[model samples]
Target: MQDYLKPTEIIDWQHPQVLSLARDLAGDRADSTAIAKICFEWVRDEIRHSCDYRLNPVTCRASDVLEFRTGYCFAKSHLLAALLRANGIPAGFCYQRLSINDDGAPYSLHGFNAVYLPEWGWYRVDARGNKLGVNAKFVPPEECLAYQPRLPGECDFPEIFPEPLAVVIEALQAHQTWDGLLKNLPDRVSVLNS
Candidate 1:
């Protein structure tokens, strides 16, 4: 609990600028779903999507993305998932393969998030900023969870996770560097926002 309270991780919880926000926001949420919903709203609406910081992949942390104010989808997932975890909601990463109409990158896959909703079970959400860096137009609907990523056999998730993740798993299986597998999309929003 103390670890998340550090000035760095606070942004991952919610809007850092709000006065007297925590006691009210995190204190009385009716259920885990509600808390997760608020978290979804904040990340969904407030954080802008960009590819900038994600290039290295390893540097991602909820604290870094929230404090710096920009990140790729995975960073956004980390931020939201960390907040959900901090708030006592069990959450984890869920991703899928999505190739661009025109292939240009290394892997033909995309990443998103999945949260344990208790009564409703685990659900999905995409926090990636718009492909063109437009945050306003990309709002995730509740139905997005219908599209889920493959889960690992070791993972507590109900389904099986796919190949892009398999490349990561194989490297991990070989005791190779897991950090090399992640992609940092790109971003300039954090700079301009700051």
Candidate 2:
């Protein structure tokens, strides 16, 4: 969809660095699926997750995420979307509400991307950077996201947003450090009720 391909303040796929990286990643690959996989893996492996690495200067926009090479899960999604859109592939944002500690009580939004593939339609992928227990891959028609909703409060959101949620952007902009963002991670119920 044109809506998913268009650049925005958060997606910012038209930025020089993003454009260049997309071009570099796509590199002589004519297949959209292949190009999409390359871009997804790059973001998933190359970019550092803020909380996992305890990195600072929280980033929101796609350019800033790529520039700093670090971002929260939501911010990382922005970069992945930008990269896919840069290559003329349609991409959009998706979210999941999960227990912060895999226990109950605290639940927050986890963000990832859904890319439109010609044969498989829109497929969801998580570029949140893999760790010891987490592994996300780009296998079409079969999603392998980093985290699944297992707790009672946790749920997988069905909508694919053309733009990053306002709450996500606001939280990223408001927090200046990894701990700050972690303490105040955005929740989905608030967004739904409002």
Model 1 C-alpha lDDT per residue in residues 51-73, reported as the tens digit of each score: 33333223255665565565556
Cα RMSD to native, each candidate?
10.8, 1.0
In model 2, the clashing pairs are none
Clashes of each: 12, 0
Cα deviation at 75, candidate 2, in Å, is 0.7
lDDT of 2 at 22: 97
Worst 10 residues of 1 by lDDT: 154-163
Summarize candidate 2's per-residue lDDT along 1-194 as a digit string, tens digits. Answer: 89999999889999999999999999999999999999999999999999999998899999999999999999999999999999999999999999998899798989999999999999999999999989899988898999888889889988898998898889999999999999999996767445
